[model samples]
Target chain A: MAGTAMTPYAQLVGPVDVYVAPYGTAEPAIDAAVPSTWYKLGPTTGDQTIEHSGDLEVFRDNDHQAPVKVTRPEEDLMVTFTVVDMTYEKYARIINNVGRIATGTSGSANVKRLGFKRGATPTEYALLLRGSADSPYGLYPGQNYIPRCVQSGNPAPARGKATRAELECEFMTLEDDTQSSDDDKMGWGTVQIN
Target chain B: MPMIDPIAAILKLISDNTNVQAIVGDRVAGKHKFAQAGSVNAWKADQSCIVAKDDPGTTPDIDIGDHVGRVELRCYGATPAAARKIYNSLIELIRDLEGRTTANTSNGTALIYSLVMDASPFTTVDPDLSIDMVVGYARYRIHEYALEEYQ
Candidate 1:
């Protein structure tokens, strides 16, 4: 008599691919094929961090030492990764699309420049992460989708060495009220193990 | 699991270079000093030659199976000036070492992602073997994905 078989091959373990597009769109990434308007943030140096957090309300009694119950009212989802492929577009995205590019001829040598300014508000994007599929866990590649996401924290790219200059960026998702269900508001994925 | 032969890769890096071949004339080989089945006289007939052998052990990435290793290069010639010529050719060859995918220069399953010399080539003596030789060390970084791609 055999029990549940170990499914190592079905485990989702590999590099995650990050993609981004404009916000408020119906579907930016369709059938795992990124649209022309979308941009794939190139090679990341290390692991992609997926974090899920929520505001917990603990009900405590005056006489009791421990809390009775804890309830979560709001939840947040964030993903962080370091992009190694240095490009004007990656810089602009980390800065929430404030930067712009222009070309000019400087003393007979054609030069392209990426320029940006301060006080500009952040921009929203439809973030898509294509992770490996977990067959036994019934998790698919296209399921992890965030309809509205905005970059969070300050981005500092350290330069120099045999190591490539990497821009570390973190993005937090916003609730998309247009969706019918709560699960569809932020994003959906089975990322837990018990 | 077959590992990459850094010695062969180093030898290929030298033998495949036109400038080095011009100096040593296809006499580049492994640490055997003579790969052909011949007597010591036959081996020394074309005394101007280059040989390479890898250092024992490796330093790999913590998680991934990428290997970081070193290879020692030996340049032998009949005269001191001739040995220096081979060393000079190696110096010129090292200019194009960065960002090289070993698939392009793989002589026999020796793959490398990148390479750089530890320092400038220096002179070494072998009175017993009786030859003028110069020695240098090259460090190489080989990624696991490159080997997986080959598989």
Candidate 2:
């Protein structure tokens, strides 16, 4: 059955589309959140200056030699991540079996949790917009937003033709609760990466 | 040289410059009152002498309290004014690493800038305000790569 029907390896790359509710597009909200006064120093030639002031501060420069810096006031907030854990899974039956035992019913199911780092700060993120992918939770259509996830690639099409789990994700945000402890300083959010 | 570790660099910076103190330990000592000295006389104990005994070894060592870590900064200069000036210069130097400036310049542009024609009376007398006039500087650093970079 192993004939010489070879195929080229596929590239694993795609834009990360991100979306937010209550807005048609996230770009406007992101732009509006940024302050107009924010700016970074420039280099001599062809130097790009990045400016931002939002719920989070932003800084950037074209050249690596001159790195952009953002200074937060003592009273201002700072966001940083604490690493959690990363896991890999390759079975849907196990997930279905567990679900059936817990819920007392099961038709079929899929489960995957990769790139799930504990306490991973979620302040900074790279979103690939302009895609038709939906969130992993399936809350939205596949034409709108793509949530965060870790990614691996499959080259051969003959490998069962089923989409393999690439990355796991956790969308987190800092909670505004005042009664929470230091470890819970970031609050908590849902994790939905497929 | 490139500091191998950032935290070490920060701690070293604080230690070398600031009069920082660290709390080492806290402990509880047992206290006991002794009475009936020798065969007849009983001992009356006060807060100060509740642990007195025939031999120094018989009683626990007196302890004031536990030590707590603290940091205090002291500046020196030609005069009090000069000390202040120097201190300020050092503070600004640290702030520089934090990408901060008192002049309010960011994003390679002037957030607040003005070309003043008239000199202040204070500056006019000195002609040039040197580190001799600075007292101290305080700064905090924030590190966040702009999302625009990825864009």
Clashes of each: 0, 28
Report the lDDT tens digits of candidate 1 across residue range A76-125: 89989888877777777776672465678889999866665524667888
Clashing pairs in 1: none
By lDDT, who's the top model here?
1
For each candidate in turn, the TM-score is 0.52, 0.17
The C-alpha local distance difference test score for the whole of candidate 2 amounts to 0.23
lDDT (10s digit) by residue, model 2, range B28-117: 011222234674333222211111011111222133111111112223223445444434434443433311111211221111101111
lDDT of 2 by residue, A73-116 (tens): 42212221111111221111111111122222334655443332
Model 1 error, position B35 (Å):
13
- TM-score of model 2 vs. true structure: 0.17
Place model 2 in a CAPRI quality band.
incorrect
lDDT of 1: 0.66
In model 1, the runs with Cα more than 4 Å from the true position are A1-4, A27-32, A132-143, A161-163, A190-194, B1-151
